[model samples]
Target: MDILLNVVNYILGFGAAVFVPLIMFVLGLCVKMKPGDAFIAALTLGIAFTGMNTITSFMTGAIQPAAEGLADKTGLALTTVDTGWPAMSAIAWAWPFGVLCFPLLIVINIILLVTNKTNTLNVDLWNVWNLLFTAVLINYACEEAGMGTTVAMVLAFVGAGLMAALGIKIGDMWAPSIEKITGIPGVTVPHSMTFTAVLMFPFELILEKIPAIQNNNVDAKWLRDHFGIFGENSVMGLIIGIVLGAIAYGELQAALTLGIQAATAMVLFPMVSKLFMQALSPISDAVGDWMKAKFQDGRELYIGLDWPIVAGSNELWVLTILLIPVELIFAVVLAPIGNTVLPFAGIINTCCAVPALLLTGGNLIKMLILGIIATPVYLMVGSSFAGYCTRLAQTWSPDSLAGMGENPSITWSTMECPDFRWVLVNGLSGHVVAIVLLIVWLALFVLLYKHMAKRNVEIKKELGR
Candidate 1:
């Protein structure tokens, strides 16, 4: 029965993944958009952003050894999974919800569009999916490559920003020349692509031979010097040689630190300006360049402005605060509900965070409500289905469990035994305590919201709104 159930569950989970995207595409079609457009949007939202779990899994597998080695070197416990409240909740629930809540997400988005008078469906903001996906992917890549979180975040921010900016800048600069040369309307040489490709081999070499340099502060100067090399041939050689020499000297820590900081500054400068563009003519330079390209009938004008880069509204901090309780409820309450019907079923809770974050527009309150309501249903229905599918996989691939015997070895018995006495005492009880604390936090948030609402009402009355 367990085996049969696991099979059924796997099929159901897979179905949900497929169905949700299809429904989203259909919704797009209803709005006179192409199916491809809808798929792209869904991909941006679902697979691109929320699929960080898959990237994390890959990175975890790759970086485990490096992390352990770092721990051995630094003697700091920086390698362990963050098992704190909401992070723990994410571990327990985010992935499962990602898989199960596809259809519900479509329904929710539709509702939000229909009901909200002020909030129009900004397809542009859907770019958040791209940002989320890229962040996670880059994060995993850096971590797996032995880069610490701080270093990775800095590099990612710098690298992505520089590449994006250079691409736009170079494209703008070369637009007229490219058009005159090629006679193509929207086709122009991608300066960013050239820059990236040029840097790739050298970057890889640096990462490979002198892995420790990832901790360094030399990245910024390197980018600045190389930033001007598109014009000069000999300068390019000099840049390459310097980069190689730095890596050979294993000054990665310095290089990385400097590079990240510089890159961050470059990226954030424009973003900050965009933020206060209303008060100041910030990014006026870039805007002027864009206008020149458009006036000149250059393809470079198509390199649209990345509003997020221009506006420092990452909102990650806001999302984190809002998501805490939702994560807690799913990890603590809903996970157990699934486990009761299906042994080894607690892992499915990892899916809950996906819907909570994506569907709720990263709103903490909505996520908390959804987590309270939806997790139980997912666990009951989704886990039962997933558990059964896993059993089926085992049955089908007997060699997958070939080592098992009627009288399995003591070690195996200890490891695989269903006995949960210690687990209940340690894991369950500890989780329960965590959940209680989360509930208190939620209560405080509710009170805060109420107070804010009252203040808003008072302001509205004063203004006669």
Candidate 2:
């Protein structure tokens, strides 16, 4: 197990910039593309990922100061530190048993695909960490309940498989919405990050039924046509950045600098997205062709990608920037009620924003409310599980919390496990409340799965798809 785990980690350790391209290169050749063409496609994907990572660094550079400024200005001192998903993912991989989940999920995905149970060939293999983390948490719960290691691991792996299937279903339902919203074809985000949309689905649908909300047809494009540059996406980003900077720094110079940075991001994100779309085409075409050949219905196959594919939408960034102060306030308010997460590291919160953008069809009002609704949940989950996460970090990967303190509680605030999965796993620990909540969450998902398909269709027609 150690040898196999080391090999997998060595490859994945190269990160998405390498791992995704390597997979795509192999997949491209498997689908019968010429070696030269496959190489170009793979390299292009590598470049696109590299560019996205660079932009992410720029975003973090801008936001980190803003986060610090917000913390300083607000004077809040929540105890648990939010390390964000990257650190948490590393912690998941460090779990001695987590390596088993890597291959297990790969096989599960293939089985699901071949059985016609899920349409997504989830090539977003790096996110297997999400499943691993889920299982690790479940394993902890089972151990606390006095289960043996063998029983705990079996239960953990079972829970992880179910969650993966749920995510695949979500991605399948979400495919059309991605196409309708971003105009990107043959791609879907089947990763756990997108599972956040489930929280907003019913609420967005409710808002759609309200007369006032439904009747209001005004949007950014309308404002752009009538009011010109002020409504433009880049200008909107600049305005948001300036406002955030002012709130965080309380200074003109810093505000303008951040404003320019945000505007630059708004302009560059879409340009980079164009590169990704271009590079993904050949590989996507091959996958689509392969799927058609296998299925007589000529159904198209969508590549399950990382959520960053939709991060280019100015709507996503718009809501994300606007929510920073609100999220800080949420953390501060919830501090008294066991919510100790400070909302610092994962302050960008695209995990919620990406899905909200797609589910709401870029409707800023709906997206804003959806984010507001999800914030407390993220905070509470972070708080509820911080100690376990920290303990796991200490046992398996102490370096993860090295700089925090002697024994600081660490939490991945943004990528909170979807409500049902969390509750269901906790139910295994024999908590009556958790068991009841698990049932409620399952019922909700059952209904949600029913409506989401139809809602996505409505969204597609709205986009003229």
Candidate-wise lDDT, in order: 0.31, 0.80
TM-score of 1: 0.27
Query: Total clashing residue pairs per candidate?
Result: 44, 0
Q: Model 2: per-residue lDDT, tens digit, 104-163?
A: 878888898888888887888887888888888888888888988888889898888888
Highest-scoring model, lDDT: 2
lDDT, model 1? 0.31
- Indicate the worst ten consecutive residues by lDDT in candidate 1: 409-418
TM-score result, candidate 2: 0.95
Off by over 4 Å in 2: 217-220, 458-465
lDDT of 2 at 82: 83
- Error at 46, model 2, angstroms: 1.6
